[model samples]
Target: MKSYEYIEEVKRANGLDTDYKVAKLLGCGQNKITQYRAGQTMDNETARQIAEILDIPVWQIIADMESERQKDPSKKKAWKMLAKLSKQAGAATYNLLILNSIISFLVIYYAL
Candidate 1:
C-alpha cells in the first residue's frame, strides 16, 4: 500500500470526491492531491503533512509499500528504528523546553 493507495483508501472510506477536499484538510494545494493520485513521487515532508491531515500514522502510510520491498528482518528493524526515533525526538524536545524555562528563570532572577 503506497501513500497514494493509502490516501485513496482514506478518501473512499470517508466518501469524499475530488482531491480538493483532501488538499483543504491537509493545507496543501489541490494540485498536490492530483499528483499523488497520478502516482507522482512526493517528498517525506508532503507525505507527513498528508498523514497529519488524515490523522493516520505517518510511518504506517509511508512504510507500508516500502516495507513489502524489504526482507522481513530488515523491515522489522526499520519499524523499531522509526519507533525509537519518534520517542527520542519527542523526549529531546521536551527536555529543550525545560532547559529553556530554567534559563529564562535564571535570567529573570539575575535581572531582579
Candidate 2:
C-alpha cells in the first residue's frame, strides 16, 4: 500500500481525527505526516512503526516504502517483488495460524 493509504488506514483504525494525532502515535511531527500525504516516501523507521501499528509484516512495509523511494527501474522492480513476496508470506503465516487453531480445537474436542 502507499504511504498515504497507510496513514489513512491508521487514522481510521485508531479513530484519529487528525494528522497531528497520527503523528503523535507515530512519534513524528505533523509535517512529516503531511509530507507523506504529499507523496513523500516514508522512512524505514516510520515504515516499521506503521507495520507494528497495522499488525503487518515489517519487511512488507519496508519493501513498499523502498519501492517508492527507489529511482532506478531495476531497484524499484526488486523492491516491488520483495513487497509481493512478503505479502504472500504474511498470508501464508496467517493461514497456518488459523489451521493450527482449528487442529488444536479438534484435538481438544476429541479428547473431551
Candidate 3:
C-alpha cells in the first residue's frame, strides 16, 4: 500500500471502519484525522496510540512509516535498521523485565 493508504489499511486491520471513530477514540479532531489519513508524520506518542488502535506492535508502526516513505534512500535505510533493532531489543528487554519480575516473585515466595 502507498503512504497515504497505510493508516487506512491498519485501521481496517484493526477492524476500525473510519477515521471519525479513531478520532473519537484518540480524543482528536477531524483535522488531526485528516493529517493521519494524509499520512503526515507523527511523534512517538501519536505513533504508539495509533499502534494501540491498530492492535499492532510499535515496530509495525515504524515499519509502516518506513514502507510508506521509501523515496529517501538514506532515511529509509536508517529507519529500517532502527526499526529492526528496536523490534529485537525492545521485545527482548520487555520479556527480560517480565521474566525478572516473575523470578523475583518466585524467589520471595520460596523464601517466605
Candidate 4:
C-alpha cells in the first residue's frame, strides 16, 4: 500500500479522523503525515509505530515501507511478498490459538 493509504488505514483502525490526530498518536508532526500522503516513504521507526497503532506485526509494516522505497524491481517484489507472508502468518497464529483452546476444552470435557 502507498504511504497515504497506509496512513488512512491507521486512522480508520485507530479511530483517528484526521492527520493531526494520527501524528499525535504516532508522535510525529502533522506535516509528516502530510508528507506521507504526498508520497513520502516512511522510515523504519515510523513504520514500527504504525504497526503498533494497527496492532500488526512490525515486520509487515517495515517490509511495506521498504517495498515502497525500493528501486530494484526484484527487491521490491520480495519485500511485498514478505509483507504478504507476514500477514498470513499472523492470521495462522490466531487460528492456531483458537484451535488450541478448542482442543484444551475438549480434553477437559473428556477428562470429566
Candidate 5:
C-alpha cells in the first residue's frame, strides 16, 4: 500500500466519487490526487487530510503503507530510518505534553 493506494482506499471508504473532488476538499490541486494515485510521493499534510476525511488514524495509513514499502528490499534502509525517526519524535512529543500538563497543573494549584 503506497500513498496513492491509501488515498484510494480512503476515497472508497468515504464513498467519494472522484479523487479530484477529494483533492479539492483537501485544498490541493486535482493533479496532486492523480499523482498520488499514480504512486507518487505525498506530503504529510495531504496524507493527514485524507486520513481525517476517511475517519481513520493517520498513523494507521502510514503504518500500512510503510509495511508495504518495507517489502521492497531497496527500501529497507529508508524504512528503518523512518521508523527510528517516528519513534524518537513520538516519544519526545509525548514527554513534552506531559511536562506541559504538569506545569499547567502546578500553576493552577499555586494560584488556588
Candidate 6:
C-alpha cells in the first residue's frame, strides 16, 4: 500500500529486524531509511542500490517507486522523465559495451 509498508514487508520477508539494518545493508544513512519509511521520492540510483542490497531485481524497487509516484499524481511527469532517461542511459551503456567488444576483437584479429 505505502512505501513504508512495502519496505517493512520486504524486511520481514528477508528476516531483517529493522529498517536500520536495511539501510545499513544498502550503505545509506538511517535518514534515508526513514525517508523510505515515510514515503519519499527515491531516485533511480537509490532504488537500484536498495534492490541490490535486498537481493531483488532493481525493477522491483523501481516499481515500488513508480507506485508511490503514481499515488502523488503531481509526480507523474517527473517520474516518467526519469524512467525514460534511465532507459536511454542503459541503452547507451549497452551500445558502448558492444562497440568496445567489437574494437577489441578487431584490434586482436588485425594484430594476429
The root-mean-square deviation over C-alpha atoms between each candidate and the true structure, in angstroms, is 7.0, 1.2, 4.3, 1.7, 6.0, 6.6
**Candidate 1: minimum summed lDDT over ten consecutive residues — where?**
61-70
Least well predicted 10-residue stretch by lDDT in candidate 2: 47-56
For 12-66, candidate 5 gives per-residue lDDT tens digits of: 7768888876776788898888887777767667767866776554665565456
- Candidate that scores best on lDDT: 2
Using lDDT, rank the candidates from best to worst: 2, 4, 5, 6, 3, 1
- Give the C-alpha miss distance for residue 5 in model 2, angstroms: 1.4
TM-score of 5: 0.53
TM-score of each: 0.47, 0.92, 0.60, 0.86, 0.53, 0.49
TM-score of 1: 0.47
Residue-level lDDT tens digits of model 1 in 11-102: 77667786887677667898887877776655677667756655555665445444444568878568656645654565676689899999
Q: Number of the top candidate by TM-score?
A: 2
Q: Candidate 4's residue-wise lDDT over 1-112, tens digit each?
A: 7778879999899888989999998898999999999888888899888877777787888888889888999999999999999888878888999999999999999999
Which digits, one per residue and each the tens of the lDDT, describe model 3 over residues 6-67?
45655676677887776676677867768865767655566677667654467756675764
**1-112 per-residue lDDT for model 2 (tens digits):** 7899999989998999999999999999999999999999898899989888988899998898889988999999999999999989988999999999999999999999
lDDT measured at residue 74 in model 4 versus the true structure, 0 to 100 = 100
Q: Which digits, one per residue and each the tens of the lDDT, describe model 6 over residues 1-112?
A: 3457656755776789987887776677889879876768677887776556555556655755785668566585566566556656666777898999999999999999
The full ranking of all candidates by TM-score, starting with the best, is 2, 4, 3, 5, 6, 1
In candidate 4, the residue pairs with backbone N, CA or C atoms under 3 Å apart (3 or more residues apart, or in different chains) clash, namely none
